[model samples]
Target: MRRNHTRTPLIEAIERHRSIHPISFHVPGHKNGLLVGDHPFYQGDLTELSGLDDLHDSHEAIREAEKLLGDVYGSLESHFLVNGSTVGNIAAILASCETGNIVFVQRNCHKSVLNGIRLAKAVPVFIETEWDDAGTALGIRLDAVKEAMKAFPQVKACVLTYPTYYGYTYNLKEIIDECHKHEVICIIDEAHGAHFTLGSPFPESAMEYGADMVVHSAHKMLPAMTMGSYLHIGSKRVDAHKVKEYLTMLQSSSPSYPIMASLDYARSYVGTFIKEDLDQTLEGIRELINGIERIHPQLIVQQADDPLKLIMRLEGRTGYALQELLESVGVYPELADPNQVLLILPLVKKGLSFPYTEAIGRINKALENEPMVEVIPMEGISTSRRTTPFSTLALSLEEMDGKVEALISLDDAEGEVSAGMVTPYPPGIPLLVPGERITADVIRRLNEYIVNKANIQGHHRLADHCVYVYR
Candidate 1:
């Protein structure tokens, strides 16, 4: 029997309850939008009362909604995450690896991956990621994975980021197959790829490639609320019960009803996405691109593997400057790095309209305005792309926990282990992880990033030309 993709069990249940206009005796002080001045959103801000099910121990509406989610993704089990992909990543790692286990990690994974390893007390073998001339960090190559597995035959699990923040994807199927050959659990942080399952123009999902587990930030590409995400058990290789246990422990007991409902709606939105919708979305994106290029012939628009993503850049101008210019004219981009600004185009169904002309007009205005910041000298820096195929932390997270740390200049910090993770915002790939050694190459890259006016995140006083290092 075919499952009805149109059915939103959780939302229907919430609606059924809302239709009753029940009394306000629940834990939420808002009392079903009564005290909140009928803000529309508060109407669905419910708790685990009556028909609304408990997230941690889902047996009613949430269970049915998750079942529908699993059907859509073709996973053994699927879950709604209100805490974002961060918790999903952590829970998946916790469920897969044991203390002191060797885990292979793509070097450019989000800091959350490293945090998961730390919390699990697992050791990570960082596989160096490849980069393009444009400085976009492409995902780990298959050869790198083979090399790491050859070096560490006892690897217990592998965690990878698919379709990087810039929306670049490589041969993920081959990589996942290799991990399976070695009986290593494969987990993918497909935060930017929740729309992949819609097929055709979109890249295939990691779940389709037989990953043991996969996490998605539905809000990234879908119409879900912020912090809404999904975790899928793609294969039986991972302990589904354990994954659920970790999710229960890691997620909030009091989950947001609105976020959960949005997750349900997001899944259904894609689940029912037909050929007409896909064609419509692709056409809109195509028109948007054409308009952007037609108006600003100087802007270099680079489309990634995912059609929904585009990178816009101008020679001699840092992405930071471009980002500011766009924001000043009321046209905001997803994020800006040193080299380019990333735009996540809308994934609209048929009959829906996005203001593409207005957006292009705004872009024209923004680009025509005076430069937001003085163009920093666009000096070429060493790409710092190559490292040993496999590297390890100089000290484990536990070892670094109680150690004394000091702030020092990046130039002088060479040979010291980093006390914190220093990352560029938006892309959020760590320049220096908590226990990684500070090399001269790392210092050079840091200096270039600072000079380019990139927004550096995590622990660092880059404005003062210093970073925290373990004493």
Candidate 2:
């Protein structure tokens, strides 16, 4: 099939809609951006009109586009999402599990998954992951999920974040099979993995496997307008009708036509040119990694199952420090933590080579001239701790317990129950959740927060400040 690189059907559709000069009887007051002057998107802003189909009730144009998307992804059904992947995650959770059902979730999933649990009112059984020697956390191991299912036999579903924000991927096929054996539905948060299905050399997407439901943030990697995403239902195991109901409830009544159009355009873009672009990008990434390896032998650039996510580590400086240096050199990574910085490479913009080469050169020069120092993994005092959910934690604060105390200094927090979830944002996984008793180990870890000067949220009191607590 000969593909037209410049002609985009979605873009053409929007243009065609504008040509009709439809009257303003719809919800959007912009009236095709007539009220908002001189905006690039003015012409594309549209409401449902003749020929242009409605998002929620798709019978014409929207349905055709969605069917095309399904064909491209090889899924049972693909629903266009204008709201971010958060909506898709919530819909998937709501559709798969009943209210008050128990769900096993990876400890390090995004805040959206947590929100989904709350929205569904499902009880979450957290499955802990194995920590590396350096105390860096990875994906949930298959054995851990199996053990969790064994312990919580009634768990209705299991949620996993593939290729975590840190770029760690687990064996999805094995995990999905394990979940299926226990009659637990498998739902995946592939927000960071939107580009995985472009036939890139990266690991296969969750949808590519047998995941019952998969949520993707197309804007993360694809050339979709921001907030453009999709909710994919793989097979009959997932209740597609229930999913549709939840999606309608969660989504905006008046959807953005421009965003929807962009999603359609992005799907076509990947189908047409992604393979070539991905190959070129992978080669560039290889060259970039090799250059860094030659210059700084002591530095470690972590490789992932994903080719798009680039993680680099420096010896003398923390990942946060290195991130700042990279930003100073006009090279910004997607996200950074104490140990690593993640870069999201878009296949759409693969040909730009000088920026990457120059950034590598700067990093090499900095490593060579800078004084070498031993890279020490941050450590802290250990304290006795226990884990509890946000609901239980909140309830516990109201109930008097002599063992629990109000906020105290990190140095003095030993022998105290943690009143909140101490976690780093961007990747908002709770390190020490509320209702957990603080021990010497917890206090020691709390004190070592110099890296990134990371701010901890999800708590009322921190560092000698006490908000309300039980007894």
Candidate 3:
């Protein structure tokens, strides 16, 4: 028999408990919003108590909710992640790999994936990612993974990021099949692809391709609170017990009740989404896009494989300047990179309305009020840097374990091994990874980012033109 798609076990449990209006004495110390005062949602903020299942143990409502989640995603076992996809990525790596094990990683993966590799004490062999004309890094080609498997036949696991940050997807099924053929456990960080299960037009999810494990940030594409994510164990190859243990160790003991409830709600939201809902949402998007195009003939709006993401750019203006102009009119985009600004449209349903007309008017006003400044050409910055099909760290983890660090001029540090990660925000791909050798090309890219004033994340002294290196 088919399970009821409309039921939300965890959320229902929370509401049942909230209706009682029981007295406080709980750990939260908020006293049921008595102290917070005037915050509407604070009264629902709860913790582990009778009738409310513990996140780690999960015997009642949470367990039932997770079962519903598994039913929706076709996973053998599914779990709610309260610490965002970062914890899911780490737990997946820990469950699949042991210390000193060889793991395949996509070079353009998020920093959290790299941190997971570091924590697992696994050696990473990074497969190069292909880039588009707009300088956005895309998924690794199947041939590249095959070549890596041929070279590193003893690889224990492979972690990949499906649907690039810009929402581009490639042949993920073949890549997962190749990993399975080599007896490598496949773990996917599908942070931006939680809605792929909606089917049609949207690219297929990694889980559908039989990935051993897949992590999804429900908050990214679904109607969930921030930090609410899901981790699915799809195959028997991985140790489910180990995944649970790591999650128990990594996640906060007192998880937020609201976030978990939202996870349950998000799952039901997707499961119950109908064709009418999709049609309405797409129509709203179409109107928004058409109105924005009317603002200027030169404006470029590029749609990706994922219909929800929109990329806007204009000639002679940097994405940063466009982002600023949009913000001036109270319209902020998801993020802005050197090449373009990304917009994340809401996934609405029937009877719901988005203020598309108001947004278009604000966008037009922003453009008319602030004239765009021509961006200076970044000469000598090589957008297409040649990278090997597969490469390893310049310095072994053991070798860099206790190495002394020294601050040196970035221009003079080309040959030195980096002691930190230097990543550009928005996309969050690291230009330099810890234990990787700094090259002249890396320095040039860093300089380009510095000149463009893109937000740089992680450790670095780019303002002083210095970086930490293993001395």
Candidate 4:
């Protein structure tokens, strides 16, 4: 079948170059697979050849391709990234703010942004999300941003995660306008919504609404090799020159040619066929939803604010338990929390249709005659008020002085502070951040999680079988 998308010029150029064998006089020792005899796609992997341009100092092919990407996204500049969205977050944070500057960030942001703040030595003003008790997930509200800005007017930048891991998206246009009114540069982590520009049935891409900068993990939702991502400078508010400097500093000297090629290929794929691919994927999803409704009748598939992500809740099983069952049946989920399992359906992939359907059928059959189990809400522990510099608290776990243990009683940890970010992994918002006081409410949830055998991390156990508290 003839593909609808235009072939990526750079990728096509490389393919055309590969068709006719060229002499080996370039940087990569592989020399068109001669050096690395068994390497895959080595013949196409050439380093800075006469015609092929350099990624960092692009002038010809790379420059042209990136320009096309910029044009496609309607950005001031777009740089193809081989280091994933983590690097883009770091680069964006570093470029936009200086040390001691305050950055208002969504509390549910990826650890990468937190690390970027730490690296930049910037003060973080966390904007807490409105937690949906029934959903057990966070939904971003514009009012929270307004409240945070009111409290921290000196915030230099506002970083938000658009379409959170569970596919919850805030109103971007309104938020962007609000940030601009305050002269705060808006940096959006569009890591999960890279294919949003291909158009609905997906939420709008951050770039569409005039964010100062947007970072996308192309590999996450598009058919690009893993770790492929892009950093888009949207408005004149962003200093593109500084962003380039930061990108150069964070990026590796020797870039992956194959990964870059895949990125270029993916851009072309989205440019040409993303609409059709998305339509087909949505149809498949509709079919899956209908099948589940017909078969299980009682299973609740949590509807996402964004359409691409599929989240479901099983009547009798925890998300972890369901995840195990899915794996046993040769199906894998993108993320699973206590109450839900998430599936990321990439428009570019075709392998998930049958297996996903079959897996749902199996789950339905297993629950056929079983009575629906009521999901019990466990009370979480709260912490006492204590203010400490993050620098003083983030001392190495080994230096903190105790063996890791779980199931600590709430009564014993009265005056102690926590040494870890204790939260559910899939959602990953810390319930008790490092150095926070541990209260009975916090202990209650930890104990319940332990009793229920939920996966836990980052704490030590004492000889008394209680969780060892950090001093």
Candidate 5:
């Protein structure tokens, strides 16, 4: 049975504390925004005071807030995450698996997953999820999980990113069921799927799929601020006590109270209005997209794309070119790379008018101004992605030593052990990760991104400096 979604203990606690208007000699030097002088934060800025409750301990308002969060997400327990889903991933992986256990991981997992594995000192058996087996699009097929499990029965746990950066999800309940059949713990990074539970029309949340544990970035799809994430435990098999301990270890000793309050308010707001608002909003966006398709036949909408995320494949231009054109026309996108542009939407599009008509008009105007440029998808690629056997750079606890060297150029990158991760910003998915031998195809992909001027972040400076290689 679903519990009450109305109570917002954390927000209420903050409001009460702020309402009392108590003078401060607390740890925060801001003194409830007084120091900042006229800044917006002064109202909600607070510390762990009487009735406010500590996040690490979570006895009063924090506990109650988590309960309300659990009720909204259908979790056995929920912990407010101030450190983003990164800490949630770290703590969840550490808490669930014993050190030295082999974990089945999705190859397309965010960099944080690798960090979690390293922190836990867990061995990884990477599961492949390439698009059309061409190594561009990424998602795990159900059969892939079955095959990996049949191959590695000794694997103690499995972690996957559901609703990937592009907002793609598989039949997750079936996957969880399969994980249970193998007695493997299942952890889901539902960081982008926070809005799934707002209504039935959206994809089913992992919480409902009975994943042993799942993490959500409330800020991603919901109205909460960035880093307002939550870690939810679903199955009784998980050691909640251990999960709590790891959370304390990984999360900050003093968390931002305002972020926690936003989480509380966002949950209450979503639980109350998301379903009805979303239903109407989706209808309007659908109508707008239909019109957009009719007008711009060259811009193809992805088949597996989310309603909130508009992933477009341009006919003549690469994703970078399309992004440039869109920006020229004032249609700001969330993220764009070589082949695609992802546009995240604000909710209630149909119910309330968002500038879709204006945005589309601008896109058409920009397309008219741009010179034609033909680009092939994955062009000039010479190699394919190697399935992880995760590199010693990742698996071993030893610091990067004499074995780690820098290659100043991409020409010599291939076949060298990668000592660093190269990830696209905004989405934070890795194009190159530690421990894998850099392949020719990866080199080509990196060049394409560089040519397109997309931002790639990692230890190696691909644009100018050396590629970190583990010998």
Candidate 6:
């Protein structure tokens, strides 16, 4: 049977609805941009009306769009996420686990996962992923998950980050099977792997591996607006209705029409042309960077890697220095660590807006005439407990009300309990979560990130080199 790859339900509905020219009275003060005249964004801006469907209700166009979206991901059901994958993670975790239940979570999980545990009033059992020598990335280990479940049979679920920020993944099928054997549902934070469904050369998506639930930041990898994401329930073990209810509670009551429509368009776009697009883009990238002297492209050779991510190091330039060089040539990279500058690509639409040939030239010119420097893995200080304090907790810290106490520095903060999450961005995993004990090692790591100018989020008084701790 031939599939209809050209359909973009929500997008077509918006276009159809806009052509009607109806009189309006709606929640959005813009009211289809009448109040904000001549603004280009107004053309696509819309709200729930007689013809347009509501996001939370989703009986009309939105429902059809979501079905098409789900079909692309091979999910049992898929829901649009206006609040990005953060809310999707929250809703999935909340629906999967019970209050006061124990869950096995990779310590490299996003900060939002900790918040979800708090909201669900569940206890977390941290499972640390082994890191490469430089500690640049954390990879999943099937044995680790098995060992964690073996140690704590009460763990209701296990959460993992597939295709990490640096674009590498594991045998999630094996791990997912291991979780199911112990009656634990596996939830994958597949935010960075949204494009995995594009197929051929891309890693298999977590949804395809029979994960109970998977959250994807569609905007991160697809052509959708930022904050747009998709939540998929891959198995009946996850209650689809409950997940929707939690999404309603967690996401915006007034979701953006442009974001939702763009999601549908992205689903249609990628589903139709990604295989061809990837071939051209990968070849173009190879031509751009493969043969440059004194420069090494840190290509992740793992089968589960996302080839779209281009990480490279110029011999004499630090990641920061290389990043500066790239930007000077009008090529901005995604993020940089001390060792390599990362470029997540196809920044512009093909045959539409990209200066592809010009970009290749710019990149080549930048690497030219640059004197080489020694290439060595720059060791970073990201110390924290291999396992979170929750692993040893006798009770759930959900009801633990902590009073904030300010400290001058973390030098003497050993044994102090954390009042909030303190994490470095790029990979926004928490270093210290609220209600966890702050060890000297964690404190030292925080100081290291601060001195290195890594963006530290959450907690107060960070600009002063001190933070408020909970007692």
- Give candidates' CA RMSD values in order: 2.2, 4.3, 1.8, 5.4, 2.9, 3.2
lDDT of 3: 0.88
lDDT (tens digit, per residue) of candidate 2 on 183-296: 789999988787777654677888888988888888887778899998888878899999999989999878888899898888787766555566677777777888887676
| Per-residue lDDT of model 5, residues 1-471, tens digit only | 765677788888888877887888986888877888848866687888899999988789988888888888888899999989998988999988877788888877888998898778787777876564223355676887887776777888889998887777777889789999888899999998888886556678888888999999888887788899999999887999999999898788888888898999878867766456776777767766775675555677753445677777677777777788788868888888777788787675234667767877777787664454564555412135455433223425443444656665778887777878888785687767777767787787778777877788887877674687776
lDDT of 4 by residue, 195-268 (tens): 78876667888998989999988898878889899899998888999999989889987788788888888787
lDDT, candidate 1, residue 334? 94
Q: At residue 176, give the lDDT of candidate 3.
A: 93
On a 0 to 100 scale, what is the lDDT of residue 466 in model 5?
60
* Residue 224 local lDDT, model 1: 98
What is the TM-score of candidate 5?
0.91
> Residue 411 deviation, candidate 2, in Å?
5.1
Which one is best on TM-score?
3
lDDT to native, each model: 0.89, 0.72, 0.88, 0.72, 0.78, 0.76
Tens-digit lDDT string for candidate 6 (380-403): 443433643225432237445635
TM-score of each candidate structure, all chains considered together = 0.95, 0.85, 0.96, 0.82, 0.91, 0.90
lDDT per residue as tens, model 1, 375-431: 454433325555578799998878888899999988799999999799877677788
Q: Comparing candidate 3 with candidate 6, which one achieves the higher lDDT?
A: 3
Clashing residue pairs in candidate 6, if any? Answer: none
- Could you tell me the C-alpha RMSD of candidate 1 in Å? 2.2
Query: Clashes in candidate 2: how many?
Result: 14
Which parts of model 1 have CA positions greater than 4 angstroms off?
369-382, 451-454
Worst 10 residues of 5 by lDDT: 388-397
Error in Å for residue 214 of model 5: 0.3
In terms of lDDT, model 4 sits at 0.72
- In model 6, the runs with Cα more than 4 Å from the true position are 291-304, 315-318, 347-353, 364-371, 374-377, 380-399, 402-404, 439-441
Candidate 2 weakest ten by summed lDDT = 380-389
